[model samples]
Target: MRTADSAAEFQTAAQWQSWLSQGSTFPVFQPVLSLETQTVFGYECFGRLDLSENVASLGTFFRASDQTLNTLQQEVGFTLAQQVAQFFSPVKDARLIVNELPSHLTALTPLELPSTLEALQQAKFPLNRVVLDVLLEPGFQNPLRLKTVMERCHSLGCQVALGNLGSENSQLDLIPYLKPDFIKISLTLFHRSFRDRQFRRTLEQLGRLAENSGSALLIEGIETAEELQQALQLGARYVQGYYFSAPGRLPAPLPDFQKKLREALENFRMIRTKRIQRQVTWENEMLLRLVDISFVLFEADGLLRLNETDLEGLSGFIHRLYFSDLNGFQISGDYLLSETGCQIDYRDVGRNLSLRPYFFDHVYKLHGRPGGWSLSDVYCDENSRCLMRTFSRYVTPQAILYLDVLWANFADL
Candidate 1:
């Protein structure tokens, strides 16, 4: 097959047209696996041309002017649709995902659905088993046009997928508007973004968005065991890459694919469970130490108001310290620690915290029990812009001492 490097040899539009007209392209299927089921969920059809090594890929031939590209896309689309029908007709469960450029679909004047539908019908391929995978490019600037194209595909009873998500050209903000059945996240972007601390939060947001938008998150280009594990941890429903199998001329069941996937999943889950267990155990130990220190302070000066000096001793571990009554009303001022020193904020002294979850739900359970302390899960502190875990314990008969510890410090412990 010709590689992309031979593009200079076919500079003329006629030569490119002639090449595509010969119908010399064949579809290679790449398996898209389900992490949960550890099975092949679908196959993405890559159109490969029987050309020299210089051409590299089919995409090189279609990079001419807009008109030429559009013409080439239509010809290639028709050929691919027919090829898919021929190759995947017997496959009842797995879907055949065919690539379609958004520009080609939007540019079709009278629409070219009839010819494709007729071709699939003649080849005995089911429309429901077909997925129209649209590549999001910068040229696709009009949302309405894209929506029209999506509607046309759905009207033909085929599922729609938006590919190249998170790529440079991908319109990430338009995902909600497109509402595709699958959002194919680029592996390059996924890896680059994963290095950031905020990546997990962003991934979680995307996962929720996909769930709410009724779209499945498909992480493409998963080439290693680590990548597969990370994708699974981030809640990817569909995964594709060389980790399973590279693109091939024929589609078949992978050798021991299910077993390998299940084992990897089991290992990932076990590691994740152990990590969480360690975190919980460490947090419990820190909370116990804090509780002991609080009891010592309480016994030293029975029910006395805690000032900046008293909180300074524990400032290295605690972020905020305050005392609340049995009804969850703040009696003492908030003593907060900063880089400079501990400071007392007297304004928060008469505020009621009874409605807060840590006080009303968590601490209330341990109200009457002696030597009992309630430790909260790690939560974001709005004031400090840091993760905090609140540890509440009954210091006196009428008061409860609340210690807000920075999770970062606790993690170090």
Candidate 2:
């Protein structure tokens, strides 16, 4: 588990350049998967080479390379690009995403690309199939030069990508202005409140921009199946990283593994759906009970009073309705003191109440609306906990006659 810093300790710029000149780098290809097809669409280029006591260490070598490393980086990138072009031949419609250091543009001109294109063409490679991913490390400062390079590559029919994009870095959004053919979102953003609805909305806005400008979205560093599912659900057209396939010189023979992953994802979906369905069934069942209880309470003479002990006894029933043993519930209305209750705080009923956020919301808003018996779908509380419940009230068009409760306190019933 050595990091970029740990890798840096073993190599220096001069040694890195020497390795590049000697063609000592080993190339690995990581598969990119299509969101819709769930199949391998292409491969992203990665480099690994043996360094001082470190076997096949990309992190260390790249970390150690400094300004002196620029010469070697350009040379290595061009040579690897050439190798990738050759490798992709005979795999019709398959693409290769070669990593490019921004500094390499100094050595590469519009004219030299023709020879690279010619080599690929000779190998029966499609010119449009090559995508050059411009890696945006902290040292990549020359945006104007990067723009020029991107324009030159695009004019030649090759696509350019904004690799490792970030919101904190002002330079990252420059891709939209330059109009790269694709934008590869950095993995860091995945952990940055991506599960939040606001973040998803922001992502949707970005996706819309990319769509309008004809730029494709490629999400990277999808290490887990859950992450891949979220990215695909969020409209990422392309995805890549260890979750799909690790980098290698050749495509990994993983048809069975791919099928297993697919089935696992499908199972995840089925489990979620069934869990929701179960909650709905419980809510419906509780609603029927609430309706029955409301009828009994409505026919009572006065306040129809019930106490904390009554609430406690109904805690089991509440547990069934809310599916949470931690909750307690109470219902209070004028001329209706029947508490099918637990020790739940009345002040907290609809606000600080432990029920799902949407459930609380529905109850608080239900006051003005006509209410017989109704249930809410599962939703995250403000604390991001899921809850389900049903509430029913016996009332006339002019006044509420009785209130009945079914919540987490009775969810398990």
Candidate 3:
């Protein structure tokens, strides 16, 4: 065995082919556990090589073999199957997940199986127990070829899984057409796209797609408790990553695996519940504070006639204020707060508010109750382009005060 100074030391494609042909490559299994059953759903097979000291990473090894990717991948697949057949023979329930490139599928002759499939068959392993995890790569020439391969694999009692989903190489738009039995979402996407609304929407859409197509969603690369919770919340049926266990020999039943999973879930729930309670409490307190201020204004004038000046003295979170009559007719102008000063807009004045849900449900319905006030759920305001909540209260016999509170103030709660 010769040690290379760096990955670039394997300069030529021949060097890579020579390294792969030396038969030093072997498979390591990573358990994909079922969240529902707390048991091993399957083991994903990753290829490891007996390389010289300075190889850097397996990724570098694969990159050097780009020119002969198909050949190297086929060799790896066969080796992995043989290893699985030997060591993982007694595991009847757990599936074997083997990765293959899309282009390799195109090279297969009709009605003929790949070397890995043949090897598995020779070992007397049921085809259904093997999942061909397709690694989406660039330069995929033919969709028809890939589809044919998938159909043939299915006919042979094998299952297909689309791996590295949400990664740059993954063609998400082709998911519907591929219709894999499983979709493996990469962990990197969660780190990058968690806070992004569009990406979250895409994730939600993928979840729905998996559900509708009868495909199980597997969230891969989960390496932390938070990541595990996120995967569970996103409805992943199977999860795999170092958070559970690193890739190694066949894992025995982890006695405390279920305990740790349940603890993480409980912690997540507690934190979420506390946050919601805090938000609700904050909203209630703010509304009550506004009610107190309204009473002060009423006592000062002996009549509740709120103007721009009156609203200016209030909290900055109050965006707009107006009053409605008992019959749900607007009686006051819209007093709006601005960066410079408060402004009164009369555009919507004299408009009927009777049909408004808040008017009938809050004011008219709960009019006579003591300290009667209704705070609406957070909603986007079209004019301000900000989240807001409307607080409505009966200030006087003839008037109902409507206060628009900026939801941004309590957004983080």
Whole-model lDDT values for every prediction? 0.73, 0.56, 0.73
How big is the RMSD of model 1?
5.7
Model 3 quality (TM-score): 0.67
How many steric clashes does model 2 contain?
23
lDDT score for candidate 2 against the true structure: 0.56
CA lDDT of 91 in candidate 1? 69
- lDDT string for model 2 (174-194, tens) is 666778888877666665635
What is the model-wide C-alpha lDDT for candidate 3?
0.73
RMSD of each: 5.7, 9.2, 7.5
Stretch of 10 with least lDDT, candidate 2? 321-330
Candidate 3 runs further than 4 Å off: 1-12, 21-23, 52-69, 139-141, 193-209, 275-408
lDDT of 3 by residue, 1-413 (tens): 23332445676667767766554666677888888787788888766665644222244564333555556656666766887788777876898887777766777888768778888898888888889998777556677888899999999899999877888767776678878999987666766656764465467668888988788899888888878887776778888888878777664555666786778668767877998899879877786677557333332223234545555566566788888777877877787886678777877777787765455667544646835778776666666777777888777667788888887777667
Which portions of model 2 miss their true places by more than 4 Å? 1-7, 10-12, 17-23, 51-54, 59-65, 106-125, 139-141, 167-172, 194-205, 257-413
